[model samples]
Target: MPHRKLQPGRLVLASHNAGKLREVAALVAPHGMQVVSAGELGLPEPAETENSFLGNAGIKALAAARAAGLPALADDSGFSVAALGGDPGVRTADWAELPGGGRDYTMAMAKVAALAEPHANRRAWFTCALVLAWPDGHTEGFEGKVHGTWVHPPRGERGFGYDPMFVPEGHSQTFGEMDPAEKHRISHRARAFALLAAACLPGAG
Candidate 1:
């Protein structure tokens, strides 16, 4: 469906991360609206009490939209390990429950490695659930996931939060070893963002 004509003013991204702000900024900049994060406006970061990724995403988006008095987009995502019984799903961002905590990809990988009985059963995927809620009470949601297998001990210094251990479907290298553009093109977050852009961006990229 076509976007319900983007509202006429500033739109906020219901997030506190610089990375997320940057991504959402890029996604909505072309739509003629300024996209800023809750942090940028000195707004309080809301706690995510929702059980599921989509639930949490909607909660944030709706809260921010109400707070900013503008349409808002929020996303919640995680790396779920099959062998680990889908652990780290809702807690992906909450890893250590601190700022920059999710950047500890090594720690994340170690935990997953501990769970995998054998080397081959360590399969997993990154899932992203995004919600776009407008000030007018309108909303849109999309979820995307990229399948991959863990890289045992993890590798590389690039990316974060399990990137070093995640080898996308067919690629021989991990997300940490790949360039930003390459990862963005195939990442779960990227796919999720792409869906939002295509469905709600109008002319956004």
Candidate 2:
């Protein structure tokens, strides 16, 4: 069945990642709302100083909501290695000193691998925290995750960053090879957004 549209309004998508922006676009596309990102709005970027994903998501959402004087949506997500004691959990995007701040996805994954033990029992999960903030001070938050194991030799090129290594539970293919539609079906983020859309979209009764 097709998605129902939401009442048209200006909702802010507080994010810097282009992939995230695109994904959110598809989620809200049926809503018939004009969505804009912080980057697109030329708003001052705020630092994510909160202690957790939900905290960080709220910080971003509140900032955008205040700036846009409208409801705002924000998502913060990261991967966790069960063996690593859930490290790189909220710090999925670690910054190394360099031009554009070197992004070391390969090194990060490798580090996670090296940190493992006993045949590299690579159990891991991807987690996403989403927050929706309204100008009236109403806020909603949700979390979703896909449990899976890490692959020795990462495969595929269709996804960004860690997609090549994460094999969702009950499947051998990594997210990098899952394609857009495939990923949406079981994605942690999508599940969370589904709740958000259903509650706020038009004609939800």
Candidate 3:
């Protein structure tokens, strides 16, 4: 299938996460697109029933495109620990699920550390699957990952999700400790967006 030419215009971002919205807005800003969050448009959040990041990203993107009748972009991202045999691959946010469905990364991070304490391998990686969907169902998916090691007593307070517990290889500070600009340069989401931009944005490649 020919890639859909994603010309600049209003695009619906299929997410309610403030951090994700901010990151995505920055990524697409140079393309001359007006980003509008699905939350702001009163679009209902869609359930992520898929078992993989790419599946979930497609689900969200398609849902938003159908709901808003506009092109949509979505991402499903999380951490996978090698010691746990990727036990939290798709359930990263729900592994130590919070009551009332809120995310508690601090508690989740502690749980991961405890589970990984006895293992010699503390290796882990973050994966992000990004999707862009058109109202007619033409969709594109891109994925990226950042390998790192898990740290106990999670450091920093800047980034969200499992940032505090992860220290990228060759980097001294945890992502949560790094400045946003610094983190963006090496993040999984940024990597995926780089590919997407090269393929979809004019003059970006």
Question: By TM-score, who's the top model here?
Answer: 3
- For every model shown, what is its TM-score relative to the native structure? 0.87, 0.88, 0.97
TM-score order of candidates, top first:
3, 2, 1
- Model 2 CA deviation exceeding 4 Å by range: 1-7, 95-102, 117-120
Candidate 2 lDDT tens digits, 1-205: 4432335788889998888888887887777778888899887768989878899999898888888888888999888888778877888877212356767677766666767645455788998888888766667787888899887566888766677879999987898898779898898888778777776666442
What C-alpha lDDT do the candidate models reach, one value each? 0.79, 0.79, 0.91
Reference-based lDDT, residue 135, model 1: 68
Q: For residues 107-130, what per-residue lDDT tens digits would candidate 3 score against the true structure?
A: 998888899889999899999999
The residue pairs in collision within model 2 are 6-31
RMSD (CA, Å), each prediction:
2.8, 3.9, 1.0
Error of 2 at 120 (Å): 4.3
Residue 16, candidate 1: alpha-carbon lDDT: 81
Error of 3 at 164 (Å): 0.4
